[model samples]
Target: MRILIAPDKFKGTLTARQAGEAMAAGVREVFPDAAIEIVPVADGGEGTLEAALATGGEERTETVQGPLGEGVEARWVLTGKTAVIETAEASGLRYVRPRVQSALSAHSYGSGQLIKAALDAGAQEIICGVGGSAMTDAGSGALRALGLRVMNNDGARARLGGAALSTALRIDDSGLDPRLKDVQIRIAADVTNPLYGPDGAAQVFGAQKGADAAARSILDDGLRHWAELLHKTNGTDVQIPGAGAAGGFPASFLAFTTATLESGFDLVAELVQLEKALDGVDLLITGEGSMDEQSRFGKAPLAAADRANARRIGTVLAVGRSTLNLEDVTGHGVKALAAAVDCAPSVDEAIAEADRYLQQATVVALRNLDEG
Candidate 1:
């Protein structure tokens, strides 16, 4: 039998690659002779670097400004002429313990620094993974790091971070790095929120980033004003989908450079060449740390299952846990779900030994598939 084992990270435990290995090991116990292939996946967050590296990518690390302006080390993956950058590695919430005020002060300059490093390394294309950002500065800081300048009324350059956005009056992209003119930027974001207004970065995602009602209000106004400047200085439009992601990072990426926003999952799928991997494969197995309605919205497992279904291949999932029962997802792309918790003593136990439990659960799910 030919099998494809693909899975996302198990969060605190296994990485996407490790999860695939454990699931394959379990399958080997049941079908040692089974020809298996493993492809790890991510949706543009923490696991992205692993997924990229699994596909013959190289790693490069650099030290840059953290969200709160302290120095932090971050890394990116390079595959050929393409570089993959995980935004969270540089400007994520974990770098600065988030408070309602964290949103205002956190800057995404580190992400920009990474971009500069990638460009310096002769990367002609960049895939920026936009997730878990700590800033709400509309990615101005990132642009600044790339040679764009923002000046306030005093003709003095504005500071970086969300709080400083309120003072931005004009922008000067005349100093934008010339390499940026030739480089292609693909933003890996999965959401569709715009730059400002009710469903925008500040109003929808600010409170969670440490913004209260008043702070959210301030951030929203900041974003609006920033958008106007972006339009004036660069003729960039912010009404597009994904403009609000990473605290409006895409908004600036759009205004300041030539970029296209694509689903992180689709981008990952393309990177791994999933279509070719699925050729002649009999069955597919996939899962993540969690599974439910949210997975249907562009998560890797369901995305892979959808591809499997298209090819008439049976697919099974073994997730860390699930709030919805298997029946809830019946006929919804997955053939079945084997939750690790169901095979373990407790949820904590499942997460602690996620590799073992997920492997065990995959064993059961495969047995059931074989029986039926």
Candidate 2:
């Protein structure tokens, strides 16, 4: 039998690439001679570069700012002249884990550094993956890193992060990277949330990044003010879909440049040529760390399953855990779901040894498929 293996990162445990490798190893134990192809995928959050590299891209690294305003070396990928930048590398929540929780002061300035590095390297087009960010700066920090000066009425630069945008009086693009004038910047967004409001970035994603009720409210107000300032300077409409992504990271980019927002999954899928990869495959496996009702909202695994189902190909999800009922999962065109937690002694233990637990889970999944 021929099988296709594709999975996303397991959060704190396995990366999409690592998960695919583990799944393939388990599949080999059951079907020693089976034809298996592993393709790591992401929903434009983290692991975007790995997805790009899986389909043929080269990676490069440079030092940039971290979420907490610290310095960090981040990575980007290049496919011809098009550069792929994952925001999580420099501005993700992962860097401040265990102790740091609040994204109130997290900044996207480091992401700007990565973009500048890509531009300096002769990239003509930039595909920025704007998910998995820890900052709620509405992208002002990223703009500043790219040479735009964000200043208040006092003629001083504004502080970085979402809360700081409240004092943003004006943004000057005079010193902005000239290459961006001729470059095509695409915002690969995984979420459809708008910039600010009830369902906006600050209220929806802020809590996870360490924002309290009071902090979220502050962030929301700041985003409102920030949006108005941007509109005045460049006519940016903050109501656009995906504008609220990664704590409004795209808001500034959309307002300041001729950037366009597109589905993060579609961009990664096109790079990997996922549709073509599924041809005549007996079973296509795809999954993420967690599968739930939210997965229906433009998440990568659901998209992968639907594509395979259209071809009448069987699709299975080998995930860390699934919170959805059988009907909801089946409705998404997924034939089966296998969770690693089921085989693990405890959730913590499973996460700690994700590779071993996930391999055992995949074995069970493949065995059932064989019997069926």
Please report the candidate that would top lDDT against the real structure. Answer: 1
| lDDT accuracy of residue 172 in candidate 1 | 84
Best by TM-score: 1
- Residue-level lDDT tens digits of model 1 in 1-372: 999998988887899999999999889988999999999988876788888898999999999999999999898999999999988899988787778777888889999999999999899999998888899998888989989888998999998888788899888889989898799999988788898899999899898788999989988899988888778876777867788999989888787678888998998888888889999999999999988778878888888888898889989988898887767765655676788999999988998898899999999888877877
Off by over 4 Å in 1: none
Backbone clashes in model 1, listed as residue pairs: 100-210
Model 2 deviation from the true structure expressed as Cα RMSD, one decimal place: 2.0
Candidate 1, residue 197: Cα displacement in angstroms equals 1.8
Query: lDDT of all the models against the reference?
Result: 0.87, 0.85
**Cα misplacement distance, residue 269 of candidate 2 (Å):** 0.6
Report how far off residue 199 is in candidate 2 (Å): 1.4
lDDT of 1 at 39: 90
